[model samples]
Target: MSNANSDPLIVSHDLESISDVMRIVNREIWVVTAAAGNERGGLVATWVSAASIDDQTPTVLVGLAPNHYTTQLVEQSGSLTLHLLRESQLDVAWNFALGSGHDRDKLATLEYLLGATDAPRLRDCLAWLDCRVFARLVTGERHLYWVDVVAAARVHPGDALREHQLFASATPEQRQQLIANRDADITLQRPAAITWRKCLPEHLYFQPTQPTN
Candidate 1:
């Protein structure tokens, strides 16, 4: 017997249900910034998290897709800077995620400074952490790096952006445009895995239903 959830049609219809659950997961939005010599690149990401609790050894994990220019720079430089975005800094998030560093300099248009790790520290962020690559593992389609947090600073000390908030606030059209732009960037990376579909699968969506007789 085929599992109903595994059926393509059922899965398609359950997209909104999946999104409803995911939006409340409270993943903080971040910009993973890096520099390779003169080449500077950054990308909007939510896949960063602390990997260790050792006070003497601050560690973080940043998952970067192999196909992005930022990922290449991080590999070559062996370092990265993670920036926490403010809720108001949506433009900063879009700039890094939608634009291609291969065609133009992404950091040139933004205000930033060279950190101790030689990574680009985005000035518009609420806080930043400079990390040194301790080790790397090829995890699925992403290069998951175990980094030691060498330095950190609170730039603004204000409310940080959350992935769920971004989706909840954007209209359908705005969401669609953002997803389209992101897809274009992912195409450049040509990874075996694709990003999760951020848009609702169809115009009509259903809320979670309780048992009704």
Candidate 2:
């Protein structure tokens, strides 16, 4: 009899956790997601992963607690969208993160519109990808959502906006000046020698005379 676990398809992992990988991958773009269901929603998620596949479509993934409202909505809805936030949109990020629709409606959190499959996509996003959920993986109390990216397109040029959010274009002179000032301050603190020093030349100053006891 053939067995599922007998296959050599199981690959072992060398790393302890996917935290590092997730951080790097999330740095690609930050987005606010709002999915509609019995209770439509909005969430600021930086963590995403692939839980499974959906035929030819690439299954995108996002993890959330099973008991969270987001999970319930996603399971019932089976659809979502990724909105690439603009550079100056830190306000939106903070709002969605700290603010919730638990007591009231969170749909009015940002400027969003219905996309493929009724997924709410932000209007200020640089781009968005609408998806249909494929599968879910259970990792402790969290559920990893694997969804197929059914549709994708550029809504606006949010690359520069993202750059402005994370990295600032610092001038060469400014960087050099900053370094020099930092070094000078360090020197000043280094026993007044390594950081900086002040002394009178032997030829310009006379030695102190010893007190006669």
Candidate 3:
């Protein structure tokens, strides 16, 4: 008889076993854009999924960290735009992922057009979906927004980038910085609404700690 423990994918029986498994999981990388009044921002996101199977009422869910300026914008405007990237758009992915919008406009240097919901639809991408938030649930340190698919279109025809691909291809320095940044972000419990971090590319990968002199 075959046993589950003999499965090649199975790790140890410890509760924390899946932490390493998640790193290799195939997830689609996406750019999430949003606007609130005059404020607009976007970020690279991997936690997105179809929330409904109904043909008449299509729905989707995106998880955004509350500390992000883009998350605040979506919370205020109740809308977001999810953009799919091509394999050739690695620069675009890093451009959005490695910055904050609090100090400057992250989209200022990019080409995009305002969609029906006033969210920016990136010009250089495989596809985009404009969504309107219907409800939000607090999940861990992130907020999962349930939204209706208001508009969608494929702007380009190409293979989309995947989360596993990025992690696998990242340079050693980049991977180490990402790990450090992620750990710093986890330790920070920023208030629900506040601009505590500056907008800069380096801020996305490394969070410097000041020494008490």
Q: Enumerate clash totals for all models, in the order shown.
A: 1, 4, 0
Please provide, for model 3 over 20-100, each residue's C-alpha lDDT reduced to its tens digit, 9 standing for 90 to 100: 767558888899999988889988899899989897999998999878899999988999999999987777887776758
Whichever of 1 and 3 has more lDDT, that candidate is 3
- The lDDT per prediction is 0.80, 0.58, 0.81
Give lDDT: candidate 2, residue 143. 62
Model 2, residue 45: C-alpha shift (Å): 1.2
Ranked by TM-score from best down, the candidates are 3, 1, 2
Instruction: Name the top lDDT candidate.
Output: 3
TM-score of each: 0.75, 0.57, 0.78
Tens-place lDDT digits, model 1, residues 87-198: 8987777677665789878787888899989999987789999999989866335788999998999988779998777777777876887798667655654333333122
| Candidate 3 residue pairs in backbone clash | none
Q: How accurate is candidate 1 locally (lDDT)?
A: 0.80
Candidate order (lDDT): 3, 1, 2
Using TM-score as the measure, name the better of candidate 1 and candidate 2.
1
